[model samples]
Target: MADELKLLSTWFSPFGSRVKLALHLKGLSYEYVEEEDLMNKSQLLLESNPVHKKVPVLFHRGKALCESMVIVDYIEEAFADAGPPLLPSDPYERAVARFWVAFIETKLVEPWFKMLDGTRARAEMADGVKQMLAAVATLEGALAQCAKGRPFFGGDGVGYVDVALGGLLVWVRASEVLLGGVKFIDAARTPLLAAWADRLAALDAAKAALPDFGRVIKHAMMRRGAAAAALAQSN
Candidate 1:
């Protein structure tokens, strides 16, 4: 425990998934502690991330690291020589990747999560889905430019932006079924993203890191139900 790295996570969270992806890509071995229930917070979690009290808290060498992206960032820097570099060597390219990562969070991630948490009304939720698709369309363009005929956003191999968004692939796929087959990463509209999703999914790190599709869908459905009930009561 003193010398080893530990990750506190829930099985179905994309935030946790991304951190796991980064760790796996780096070939890092970590102890994963599954938090079965968020409502009943674990002592380790509370101590690890008191400010956010959220999952995806990573403990390295007896110290705690909070937030998923922050943890990913830390993993990349701390374990730079452990595996392939997630960010590019050039500062400009790294900046570009970081920008896209920000876009993924503000545009795609926020909207998708708003719908997931049932924080919005029915009409608002529909609008949220629209926002998500719009972000996907934007990322489609970003991918074409960034990839330059390569297979990934980072080119050839998985890069920072790829790990950032790739973590959400399972949820994105689940959202299609949740939306009655509405395609967020449409082959027709966002062909790059559609293909990117497939390639990223096929990666060994992705397979090891990502939550199971069926289980994610089931867990999300239950969360949606709870959120809907709460929203209905509030309304």
Candidate 2:
């Protein structure tokens, strides 16, 4: 069953990367269909994810799952007895793991949208930066507290929690260029987070699933440049 999984994702989306990492971690082979034009989204994407009309949709045996985290959860459940378990068996710890995922999406990813979309006003960008900083600081503190004695977020191994938070680090690192020369995972300010990122990147799954940061950055720059040119033409 795992052999027949199919993933629909955009190259630049951190959300998409999360599911890819999960699949790689489980040693699953599936079709990876990249969405080239977001504007003219494929019928599969719209049909698979009717609600969100978004990418990172996973198709398994003709069943579809939307939302990156939801897809990761599905992957975890599908291969639970076979691969490295994503969710801890303990219910209490599973809840904690889920909390961080929610925190990253609602608290961090949301602000990142504003920061990336150059259409945002100056004040909005400032507010977004402020919010992103606050969220990052909170995540840093929480990770430090959690890593008191161990390495990964799941004590000794990379689990759902680690994949949930750590998957975004690469994208965040790439987007540092957008933040006016501020890097997100500086060892000095975010030592634990930085180290954790290095550890995740070292993993075979993480390495395989690592997005092409350069290409994504180039795409972002092109978008920004086109937008700026349009604005200048309007003026």
Candidate 3:
């Protein structure tokens, strides 16, 4: 086989999972190549995504696509017939879905990556958690508006926003444990989002694409522990 479609990814990368979700949802088959060491980059990955030098470089028909969301967009456009649509058919609704995807990237995703960063002080990390939680509350409201009381942000089915946020579900679950039981999406506070998580998780696509929670948590623990040690040394 010429390997028409190939995915270069790390096991626990939510970004990688996003690409996986799109592939799985579209029911597209591809070769999965795990990047063993990020520090030691593969020539293929390096050539594919020289700008970022990151995992989740998707090669389709010998053409390389970099970035997670970009890959999803590609899948949605290129393989529209492969499965159900993720973006909305209505232009306005499509715009709305894209808007939420951006929000998740900035408001939720940024702070998440910020929290427990080894270079930053613990206090700064605490601030990150606060910001992350605030984003969650905002997303709770967003889900109501976007999903229109439906189970997913995509309403009747898993759409753009669902994949955007759902990609991070495993990370969010791992983070909850890593952060000493802080509930980002609380049933009491953000009932819709809390329920949405459970519902999205139950889907076949999620089960297929989402990384193993235990593996992610184990990796996250190492990072958190290192960050904590760095903070202690700086104190």
Candidate 4:
């Protein structure tokens, strides 16, 4: 019997987007339950992820799995025979993939959040942007090493690191718009990485999994407005 699968996610969450991308890459058909308000989460979400109470929780065969990356790994393992492999078969390659995924989750994302919240002064925010760009440069180098002239990090296919970083493109693009057209990834600064991002965006799975660009921009604008208001009030 086929296992019943359900994914609890929120539309704007890049973390949740990772899980969606993994599922699509695996060609897994599952119910997507959107949580409208995270503060007032659904009972199902609460019950499914009592510890984190977070979205991107995967329920397979009546067991709940929390954390976006963890859920993605689980999907890759459980559906190993169902679709293209997310992780490379070679242990060394798999370890390298996991390393970059960890770098993306731990090193890159927090600085991005700080930049997004806009709580820092002008100099601090500039430094934050520099930090983010440095992280991108590191990723670009890693991709260049692994891509080996292929379009993706996984050599003609999207793999673990691809899903890990690809999901954040929306937010990164939105942040550029929010910052009055400050370019983060572009042909001039990050040509290879920028091209890779474009390729990822154009993929059918990405088009299906990612939220609309307009929606992301609008949400980002709202957050920027709120941040600006808060900054004004503080002065």
Q: Candidates ranked by TM-score, best first? A: 1, 3, 2, 4
lDDT of 3: 0.82
Model 4 steric clash pairs? none
Over the stretch 21-69, how does candidate 2's per-residue lDDT look in tens digits?
A: 8888888889988876666778987787787677788889999988778
Ranking by lDDT: 1, 3, 4, 2
lDDT (C-alpha) at residue 163 in model 1: 89
How many clashes does each candidate structure show, in the order listed? 0, 0, 0, 0
Instruction: Provide C-alpha RMSD values for all models, in order.
Output: 3.7, 4.6, 4.2, 4.3
Q: Where in model 3 is the C-alpha error above 4 Å?
A: 1-3, 223-235
For model 4, residues 108-155, the per-residue Cα lDDT tens digits are 776776666665777767777778888888988999988899999888
Q: Which ten residues in a row have the lowest lDDT in candidate 4?
A: 226-235
Q: Report the number of the highest-lDDT candidate.
A: 1
- Estimate the TM-score for candidate 4: 0.91
The lDDT of each candidate is 0.83, 0.75, 0.82, 0.80
Model 1 poorest 10 in a row by lDDT: 226-235
Q: Per-candidate TM vs. native?
A: 0.93, 0.91, 0.92, 0.91
lDDT of 1 by residue, 1-235 (tens): 3139898887777878899999999888899999766777789878878887887888898889987788888998988788889999999999999999999989988787666555468887888888998898899999999999999998988889998899888978897898788889877988889889999999999999999998877776777766333221210
